[model samples]
Target: MRTWNDSLKIGIPLLDCQHEQLLDQMDQLLEAMESQKGEQELRAIMGFLKMYINNHFNYEESCMALYKCPVACNNKDAHAKFLITLQDINHKIELKQSLELIVTQVKQELLDWFVNHIKSIDTRLQSYVKKSE
Candidate 1:
């Protein structure tokens, strides 16, 4: 179970905290799924993640645009795509897909995409912020 650490920080305290919380929630979602927790619990975590991700992405996108970060366009496109993927996952859940399938998708799509996005695009944003500062 991967956990948040300083290495994931993009030099923005608010976004960093949001990222940490997102990662923590992802872990809990995975744990609950693997432990065979109830559907209600899973839905609760999913609901929080859905809302939090939107807020986080909006703030991040605005910051990137305000800072004139080079990756701003890419960041926006990525966020849009992620939102679509999340919507698909939610649809699957509503359709009552198997828990194992949902877990796999969450791990592969949400968790993996998030870490990669942070390491690659968000790191570039951090560099821009540093230069601007």
Candidate 2:
């Protein structure tokens, strides 16, 4: 099930809202997979993933730069890599490749990256926002 757990909240309401939305879409995709749904369902997943990442990535990078984060560039690079991998995964799905392995990998990678990135990297950005307020 998709969740907006307290652990995922980054002390920024707007960002947290975005994260909740992204997770919801992800959960929908997972549910579709569990139901043996096919490529049509994956279309929405791909679209949501693309849109969410585009918008959220910008917000994150802007926040990082605005905060003069020491790791802003590194964080941006990591996000870019994630976007690329997400695209590749979608491509593989489109090619009628076995999604089971890809889905499993994506879930683990995304969850780990999301939690760590927000808690460590984003917390630094949040710290700046807090100090400025």
Candidate 3:
């Protein structure tokens, strides 16, 4: 239900773009679920999500490293936690859990986590990078 907006922007163009793409992907996943697509479709979306997360996290971490952001470690830790949570959800899906339940959990957990991460961790990293500049 969440859409990418200016409020989510961290003042970093690449990261912001990646965030938008991520939101778009999440929307697609939700749509697929709503349309009652099979487990294969859901798995495909999950694969894409994993790849996107890896790329985005790497990019963000590199930026943090480049700028010597103090919050880099915390950011990495948050990313790790998210990855673990996502994997657990995927495992549950693999176990033939109800699609509705999986979808709801994904929507709630991911949307909430992403919003908080962007607001807190990413904003701080952006501010630090901008200050360095």
Best prediction by lDDT: 1
Q: Rate the local accuracy (lDDT) of all candidates.
A: 0.89, 0.77, 0.86
lDDT of 3 at 30: 80
* Model 1 alpha-carbon miss at residue 50, Å: 0.9
Instruction: Candidate 1: give its CA RMSD in angstroms.
Output: 1.2
Q: Candidate 2's residue-wise lDDT over 1-133, tens digit each? A: 6545788777888888887787777777767766778789888787888988799989878887887878899899889888888787778778877767766856776655666777777766677778878
lDDT of 3 by residue, 53-115 (tens): 999999999999899888999999999999998898879877987778877887788767887
Q: Name the best candidate (by TM-score).
A: 1
For residue 110, what is the lDDT in candidate 3?
79
Off by over 4 Å in 2: none
Candidate 3 ranges with C-alpha deviation above 4 Å: none
Question: What is the clash tally of candidate 1?
Answer: 0
Which candidate model has the greater TM-score, 1 or 3? 1
Give TM per candidate. 0.94, 0.90, 0.91
Error of 1 at 111 (Å): 0.5
